[model samples]
Target: MTISGSCFCGAVTYKIEGKLRDARSCHCSMCRKAFSAQASAYALVEQSEFRWLSGEKLLTNYESKHGAGLQFCSKCGSTLCGTYKGMIHGVTLGCVDGNPDIALDRHIFVGSKALWETVPEGVPQYEELPPENA
Candidate 1:
């Protein structure tokens, strides 16, 4: 399935030609701050299936000390995707156009989630990074 996405100002756009995977919600302080929300909803995509359709030069990226990177549209400050070692690692669900066929498989860093934010019941929750990621 082909999925398309763009930044809030429409200055940046991307497309994913394959299915998304490892969908998850991250409630870590870093994530909450990055997304400016209770948590960040994301889905992974293979580099081979991901491509920037336009406004590549208008994107800015910030890399965490842990080596994870979040790329945003410089024009609108819209988070678009995550990167690892310079390759696309995942797409931020918020910027995804329409509805993509995916759901949160896990919630990570709940231990650091906002005190007022309550994770819903069901699925799986991790105090920190999941074992597979830790």
Candidate 2:
């Protein structure tokens, strides 16, 4: 299925051409700080399958520590999505056009989650990272 999404100011839009790989919430400090929210939820999309449909120039990028990059809209400063090491791409769940038929599979970096937060029910939670190394 093809999924579409846009930034908060509608300055950037994109489309993904297949089912996502893994959909989950991330509670890592970087995610929290980047989003300024309790957590961030995203779905993985292959670099080749993801396409920028509009406003390419409006997309701005930030390189956080460890060389990880977060992509957002320059106009509204909305945290639209991100790419890791310039390879795989992921889109924030909130930016998707409608409800994606997916569920939060796990919580990553639970060890770095805010002290006041509690893990949501039913999802497998990981202390530092996903089980897979790469």
Candidate 3:
């Protein structure tokens, strides 16, 4: 399915084609701090299939020493997505419009999750990366 999304201030926009892959929630500290939420939900899209539709100049990026790149809107500073090691690009699920009809398949880094939160029922939870690396 094709999906489109924009940042909080509409300073960044994009279109993604093909099937969304590796939908999951990240409870890692970096993700939690970057999103300022209990957890961050994302779907992996190939770098080639991800296209910036507008306001490209308003986008700013920060790279972690570990090779994870966080892209956000310069205007509102909303975290849009993260690109890791130039191989996989993860689009923040909350930034996508209209729900996108995709359910998060699992929760990763559950060990780092906030103490007050509970994993959703029936959704597989992993203290670390899944065995299949999904």
**TM-score for each of the candidates:** 0.96, 0.93, 0.92
Candidates 2 and 3: which is better by lDDT?
3
Report, for every candidate in turn, its global Cα lDDT versus the true structure: 0.93, 0.84, 0.85
lDDT of 2 by residue, 66-105 (tens): 7778888889988777777755478899999886677788
Order of quality (TM-score)? 1, 2, 3
Residue 34, model 3: lDDT of 85
Give candidates' CA RMSD values in order. Answer: 0.8, 1.4, 1.6
* Candidates ranked by lDDT: 1, 3, 2
Clashes, model 3: 0
Error of 3 at 51 (Å): 0.4
Q: Could you tell me which 10 consecutive residues in candidate 3 have the lowest summed lDDT?
A: 79-88
Better of 1 and 3 by lDDT: 1
Residue 3 of model 2, lDDT score = 85
Evaluate model 2: give its TM-score: 0.93
Instruction: Tell me, by TM-score, which candidate is best.
Output: 1
- Model 3, residue 115: C-alpha shift (Å): 1.3
* Index of the highest-lDDT prediction: 1
Question: Which residues of candidate 2, in runs, are more than 4 Å off?
Answer: none
* Candidate with the larger TM-score of 1 and 3: 1
